[model samples]
Target: MTDTALTSEATHGVALSDVAADKVRSLLEQEGRDDLRLRVAVQPGGCSGLIYQLYFDERLLEGDATRDFDGVEVVVDPMSAPYLDGASIDFEDSIQKQGFTIDNPNASGSCACGDSFH
Candidate 1:
């Protein structure tokens, strides 16, 4: 996977694995649109007080930091950058579980559902 930075001064806030990058690239290709980017953010109101949000976004908001894995772009907004910093994202397709997972070092605790963190 390519590790090229979008900008010299703009470093990636979070880590995106090769598997996750492939999955994201495939999904984006299926959508047939090159305008969308994979956005990762942390928001309030989960069982553990915070939850992760991952989706494709067409707009680039202010203070958005981006990193390119191959051709796929991963974005993190300013507010969510600190919360997601040093976090690694991966995709699993095993029979046991099928989805993207986040490994965050900053989380002190997480809920039972494994969907939120404190």
Candidate 2:
């Protein structure tokens, strides 16, 4: 596979659909934390080369990068930024599956289950 250098502009974080944003915002409210941001990271050691990690963060690490979209704050670590560049986050609701999904153009091929990627 061809390796391309992913840029921050290309991956300034992800886009959230209205339903996804609403769900996240509601969860935040329930948590009673107003200063929290959604954190996404690409970690090694999955079936593929990388796996996604998501959580609510109130603090920024030394090399953490932050971006805003649709009134939502997305935080990513410096190490994970390149792999996640140009990735889009979307919400899906169906009888078979309902959750947030990532559409990453930078990834040439992902794992069979779609939980990991190279």
Candidate 3:
């Protein structure tokens, strides 16, 4: 595992692993878009009541907090910031699994499928 570094703004926000940032950069490059940012938000729903939403966003809403990992920018909304603070996002690529995974310290418990958290 590579050592993940957090920016001053990211210390109280989300941390993006180097691998994940690289992946995001590659994905954006493939799409040929430099205006989008990786948005991480928590929405109400799912088995555990709260589910994570990660996607590319071009619009920057009010009160959005951003952190840069390498050249990749990650944005978290004010409403979801508390739940995602201290969370680390990493990417894994292997025969067993392949995707971005969030490790949140704020989650008390998560669903069996690991898609949501309380």
Candidate 4:
């Protein structure tokens, strides 16, 4: 049976694509971590001055906003929400690129490596 994907309306200025949600769900299941959430953040320090942060987090910090896509939950800190507004998280399982990617409309420019933006 194929699992259906349900995306929650963006409350933290971001959304996860169906493929991304599926990948997250599969990963969480593999890790056996139903208590963890996908955390997205933007921190200063990349070559372009800002970089994206993605990880599984078990702690809920103050001012953190969350949204659910299917069974996967994603968290975004208040400081990073603005930068990630309207961004979409996607997953690629191809031979060329096999990982999570962020598409941020708010980015004016990005580094050649695609790891940082300004």
Candidate 5:
């Protein structure tokens, strides 16, 4: 079976697209986390329904997934994994939009501000 079929803390549960992974790697490197992985979480907030939290963490939670990328690792909580299942976390740098955006298939609908989802 492919590595994607494996289920464990070594996998993010949700797949990280090439763009997303590249962006995340850049951020991690900038943050000086050669030994750190990107942690994606969903918190209560945003206009749509939920807000995405991206940070660097070296510690793993009780029920979290730890996936190793080219050289970086990705950490995701079980609770957040479902919401982020099949979601793509990307970073943009455009005149109109510049930041991390979560393209989540689980989000049935999103708010105008693009912060919350339902």
Candidate 6:
């Protein structure tokens, strides 16, 4: 597939939806550190062979791609960038599901738990 992440304004490998960015902003506000960035990365050893790692980080590493949405920022490492290209992150708050979800167009398959992908 094409690397839309590289071509578009979202060089961070993935795009964060408005709701997700807002939630992140809210969380950072709760923590009283709006300077922290949401770091997104890919890791191995999941049931689907690949897993996503997301968290707030204050440090910047080498070869990282960063994107900002309103007041929230997202950072992706070089290695994870290619794998997560064309991916989009969203937040959900409902009785059935309440958390962040990723919509990755490059993933061929995903685990039943929805925490891993291949």
Tell me the spans in candidate 4 whose CA falls farther than 4 Å from its real position.
Answer: 1-10
Q: Write the per-residue lDDT of candidate 2 for residues 40-90, one digit (tens) a residue.
A: 888987788889888898876666667776667788888898888888787
Across residues 13-64, which tens digit of lDDT does each residue of candidate 3 receive? 7999999999999999999999999999999999999999999998766567
**TM-score of every candidate relative to the true structure:** 0.90, 0.82, 0.89, 0.89, 0.78, 0.89
- Model 4 residue 118 distance off true place after TM-score fit, in angstroms: 0.3
Worst 10 residues of 2 by lDDT: 1-10
lDDT of 6 by residue, 1-118 (tens): 2444452344565889999998998899899996698999999969999999999998766567888788787889889999988899999999999999999998999999999999
Better of 4 and 5 by TM-score: 4
Error of 5 at 53 (Å): 1.2
On the 0 to 100 scale, the lDDT of residue 60 in model 6 is 69
Task: List the RMSD of every prediction in angstroms.
Answer: 4.6, 7.2, 6.9, 6.9, 4.6, 5.7
Residue lDDT tens for model 5, 28-112? 7778667676888998888766888888777665667776656657788878877887887667779998887878888999888
Give the distance in Å from residue 69's predicted Cα in candidate 6 to where it truly belongs: 0.6
Q: Report the Cα lDDT for candidate 6.
A: 0.87
Candidate 2 local distance difference test against the native: 0.77
User: Where does candidate 5 stray beyond 4 Å?
Assistant: 1-10
Between candidates 1 and 2, name the one with more favorable TM-score.
1
Q: What's model 1's overall lDDT?
A: 0.88
Local error of candidate 6 at 41, Å? 0.5
Tens-digit lDDT string for candidate 4 (27-47): 899998899999999999788
CA lDDT scores, all candidates in order: 0.88, 0.77, 0.88, 0.87, 0.75, 0.87
